[model samples]
Target: MTHRRKTLLRAIAPVAALTLALTACGSDDGDDSGDKKNDKSSSESSDTSGSDDGDDATDEPTEEAPANTGDLPLGQAASEEKEIKRGDGTLKAKITADKVDTGENADLTAAGFSADKVKGKYPVYAYFTYEITEQTGEISPGTDLNSTTAVLDAEGKPGSRFIAIGGQPLKGGCPEKDRELEWKKGTKATLCTTFLMDEGKEPTKLAYGMVNPLLWAVK
Candidate 1:
């Protein structure tokens, strides 16, 4: 009976040792799987943070007003010819600001402008030559070639007119024709427009069109 019991104890001991080894291996595998899941979660969190930073860079505003990038481009030089569709897109006019005259206070006073009106103002005379290159409708004399033309002051603002009344030729050759004549295609003419600049300031640019004006350097 003692020999039989000793053999049985040895067998049971080996079986218990095998069971303990298998449990230890299972615990190691569980630890490895948990570490892999933690690593994957950390990598996903880092990727999300990087993506949020890129979205902030593109939402900033600009410091200055954007330039005109429209149907008509800006900054054409004086004496360069440009064909623009005017008169409600009924006529295509070929136009150029041929000459610019400045420092005309005395001339303004002589040209029927009151002394009080001419005082404290620098005057400008801009002569433009234009022709109706093409027209789909009738053009009136009231639609003068100098319409939509302006002189920009040093501050990029349009200069005010010394005299607002139209239709009369001023004494110093700044003529305004107030006729009711009709114009046809291929008709050409020259006209003068005037502006009253601020005292002690010179005209910086001749501008065509009130909004996003096509600028010509006053040379």
Candidate 2:
């Protein structure tokens, strides 16, 4: 070989080796970049799966507790003052059933009621006290005791009610009079109600109010 050609071959050989080394480094960098991209995709997939699991856990239904709606005694009803609303006025009041009487046929006869009026029936008289503790917005304390009160038989139904007019006094000593005077704070009233049930059917309960009534067991 010529001396000039030998020097040129040596220089070209080093240049080719440097070029090969640079190409190998570039290929390695590309591989590392692809691996990093695959890792990121896998991490994103795992995060999405975790988020879906969290949503599923949150979507599960939960149970709620039941409310109490049991019947309460007369004394308990008296102890609990209820807010009564009428005609844009509000009144806080309580009722106490003090006495109950099951009348006889002789007693009915003495009260000027015919035997046919109460024949094959049980007469019931319930005495109660109505009290007003707080009043607001011009509310009246007067309540229709004969209409509001009921004597329930064994079938959980109201019996025939006897409403006396003109403030007549019953033989059982329950007056038919209901007072409607000045209703102020700390005012109270004694009221009575009467009911008649068929013979062999006894009164089991006494209830007051038309809705969400207060209950009392017959003694």
Candidate 3:
């Protein structure tokens, strides 16, 4: 009876050991799989963070420079010769104090503007002569003169009280005329434009052009 019991015990011991070994091996494999999953998750998180940092580094702002005003004349006036180069053409422009007129003129009434409605100190008129010296296209002196012309006050600011009357008669300088006259190369014309000045606010200069490097009518 004792010998039979021992043989049975030995067989049961081997079977139990085999079962324990298999259980241990399964536990190790499960731990290794969990560790591999954790490593993959950590690597993915690191990659995502690095990509975000690279995006943030590229999203910054930059500053821009100011415009150049070196070629503009600040305070020039009439009777002085100014050589202004327009697109594809050059003009010899001149303004003269001798051609400037103010007060209640008969020509202003004849043109349709009432002297009674004149704002500012009084209505003033000036004559501009544009001689197209060199050109590759037709130039409209009247249109360019009206659009780009501005009178500067004594404070070096544009006069807000003035009304621009383009293409007025050269002799009377009143009754605004639409001078759409196109001058080809080597042509010249004397055009008149009127302005109304504020009381005691004398114009110090004239500025031309809607862009930088403006042609200034200096006093």
Best candidate per TM-score, number?
A: 2
Which of the two candidates, 1 or 3, achieves a greater TM-score against the reference? 1
Q: How many residue pairs clash in each candidate?
A: 0, 0, 10
The per-prediction CA RMSD against the true structure, in angstroms, equals 38.4, 41.7, 40.2
lDDT of each: 0.39, 0.42, 0.32
For residue 23, what is the lDDT in candidate 3? 6
Per-residue alpha-carbon lDDT of model 1 for 1-219, expressed as tens digits?
111101000001111211110000011100122222112110011111111111111111111111222212222333434444333335555665666676555654443444563466655666656676666634434444444455555554455533232112334545434344344578766656655566777776665543333456565
List candidate 3 segments past 4 Å from native.
Answer: 1-99, 104-119, 137-144, 160-180, 212-219
Model 3, residue 31: displacement in angstroms? 77
Tens-digit per-residue lDDT, 1-219, candidate 2 = 111101010001111211110000001100112222112210011111111111000011111111113445554545666555543355567876665677754554444444554466555766656687886665433433223455666666455544221122345545534334444578776666555556687876665554345667775
Model 2: worst 10 consecutive residues (lDDT sum): 21-30
**What TM-score, computed on C-alpha atoms, does each candidate reach?**
0.53, 0.55, 0.41
lDDT of 2: 0.42
Which is the better candidate, 2 or 3, if ranked by TM-score? 2
Residue-level lDDT tens digits of model 3 in 1-219: 111101000001111211110000001100112222112110011111111111000111111111223323332343334454433444455432224445443433333333444323344554444555445433433333332333445554343222222213323333343344565556655544444445677665543332321334344
